[model samples]
Target: MREDIEFRTEDGVTLRGWHYAPDGATGPTPLVVMAHGFSAVKEHLLDDFAGFFCDGGLGVLVYDNRNLGASDGTPRGEIDPWQQVRDYRTAITWAQTQPWADPERIGIWGSSYSGAHVLVVAALDRRVKAVVSQVPLVSGLANARRLIRSDLFAATRQLFDADRAARYAGAAPQMMQVAWEKDPAEPAALPTQDTHDFFFGPIQDRAPNWRNEVTLRSVEMFVEYEPGAYIADIAPTPLLMVVACQDHLTVADLSLEYFEKARQPKELVALPCGHFEAYVGEAFAESAPRQLAWFRKYL
Candidate 1:
């Protein structure tokens, strides 16, 4: 079952989405707090993913990140990684107070960009009992370099410089397309064929609230983020890293390296697919059950 839900962050921004209750739950149930990757909204396969957990007797709190979807924040379509991390802590706090969620049995789930976020959140907040980071980004600077060409890197920095000047001069933040054509000569945030197909195809068809734009500063912050550094600290708390073997967006090897660094009580399952595939079709079928088992075991 799904109920419309919203909760306030410590900074006072209200995040809105749905709280799912397991069909046969008799009391407060283990709850998984979930959110999407990058600029994706809650409508983008989150419900489908949440369904897996709810059907398996787990409740879920799924919401959009700030400045996107139904959530409230200024400078719409902006993504500040640190701010998003803070919001995850706030979401966990909100979940603790809800009657449908077992305060002591809370797990956190995230995919793609949010997957990277869960790593950071779990390290910082002991409140998170279990964490499933699916096809997560480990090193932003390294991933960005992989996505962008060496020759174009300098130009990208210049663009960021220009946007910073514009913003400081009282102009709105410059925007960039999150993805471009299947074969794009023009630069886009996710300039890959798979990303284009997934975002503009299945993702766009499902989520109109999903935007194709984000502030230029978001990319800068993303590059500056290094969530993998916290992997060792996440030990003692059970950690699960679901890596897509073919994932180049976040890089499978990077995830594996970090997973190796994480302390005991951790597991890594590598799906034989790309980054986006881990969320749907056969890859999702394989990944979701594995994640549910992790949560059930730990949370």
Candidate 2:
């Protein structure tokens, strides 16, 4: 059965998570610590992945990052990358104490921006047994370049908002728009075509609180933050890199470069779709099972 668990972060914010324990399992099973991508709630994107693992005789702990969803924190729309990484660490540490989790066999899974956080967390926490980073955004600079090429004005405005939020620590300026807005000029602007369906369609059914707007301040730090730099140190431990050959949200070529630098015990699987399409379209069925197999082998 699955239960909702609430826990406190080091910064005094309350975080809500879903814990799925396999039926009739007597002891700790392998656990997957799953964190959501930018501007997304944990339950919407992660629950399916968690459910699959739980059904396979594993425990899955999926948590909402501090400022979004049901988590307690100020500045509702803020997206501080470093703070998110710290919160992920705290969540992983907390997962170790859950009775159904095997601390030594815990693995990390993330996609897009939070996918980068999985790498950051794994490097700092040696206890992370394995990691799966799917179509990760290894560099903030690359993301910035993509946004600029797609929409200069909207990208600039996003940067301004994020900086203002960081300086004030109050509620960040709100950006509201429909999910399927076309072009970057629209308020809830998206860079690619699949993003509209991926970000809005699924959440429309499951989570009412989902929004496409993220704190603009995230732009300031996201470009400079490179999670791929530490990939070599995580070697000998299992690391799975899922690359989308035609990704538009993140740089696919840069991801390939990082994969080249990474050491042994690493495997890269290339898919034919763009970034978000793989998560919702037919590829998800193909991708999720492949990832589960890799985690089962390593964890």
Candidate 3:
């Protein structure tokens, strides 16, 4: 069972989410609020992940971040870490109102930035019972260094563009097409890969409805937002960190350090691929069952 819907946040911004319940659920069940990664819409990650969890007898709620897809917000892509955390917290509160959900048995699932956000939110809110951090961005400093190593001048240039847009137009202008050049030495900075296509690539070929173009400001925000800093704060609650071994976007070493600092009842599952590959390749198929099993056991 699936239903498209919207819920208002603490600041009056409406968040769009899809509620997917088990097919034959006759009683209340644990809720899984699946948060999408940075600059991504709910339909992208939740479409597949939600189906898996719902099939496993758990209800799922997946939503777009404010100012992104169907959600309401201004100055698109002005992603503040605090604001994103609040949005996820608000979604959890909204989920409690549903009659089919067990209010005290709520879980949060995230990947990339949202995966990191889950740790931050769990630290602040005591209501969350379980968490899944998939390909989590563990450190800002590490990512910043990685970006500079790959394209220092290109990263500086994008920052300049974002600053200019924010000052003159109240929001950074969207990039319909990334500044990617075919030549290697030409300094084109996107995807961080020569052949890595953007989110519009074939992963969504089976489902082409996902549309997202982020304001360049997200580049700056991501560099400053480090959820790894607060990893030790997430205690008692069961945590699962799914690491992408060859990930360039989020370093595996940094994530491992954070996982080590986390309290007991924590588990790390390292996949044999990069950041986006798990969402597209055989890794995702292998990883989904483990995540569902963990959430079912904890929440």
Please give each candidate's TM-score. Answer: 0.97, 0.89, 0.88
| TM-score for predicted model 2 compared with the true structure | 0.89
Assess the local accuracy of residue 133 in candidate 3 as a C-alpha lDDT between 0 and 100.
93
Clashes of each: 0, 5, 0
Name model 3 segments beyond 4 Å from true.
150-190, 204-212
Q: Model 1: how far is 24 from its true place, Å?
A: 2.9
How far is 225's C-alpha from truth in model 2 (Å)? 2.1
Q: Return model 1's CA RMSD, one decimal.
A: 1.2
Locate the minimum summed-lDDT window of 10 residues in model 2.
Answer: 171-180
Highest TM-score scorer: 1
Q: Rank the candidates by TM-score, best first.
A: 1, 2, 3
Q: On residues 169-262, what C-alpha lDDT tens digit does candidate 1 reach at each position?
A: 9999999888886458766887888888888785677787788889989999998899999989987889989999999888898889888999
Off by over 4 Å in 2: 150-184, 187-190
Identify the superior model by lDDT, candidate 1 or candidate 2.
1
Per-residue alpha-carbon lDDT of candidate 3 for residues 1-299, written as tens digits (9 for 90 to 100): 99997999887899887889899888779999977776667656568889989999999998888877777887665556678999888888888998878999999999988899999988778899999999888786677687566646565656657677676876535443222335444432244661235454665464353444455556656667889877888888889899988877777888887899999889889999888777765988989999999999998
Candidate 1's C-alpha runs over 4 A off are: 181-183
For candidate 2, what is the lDDT?
A: 0.78
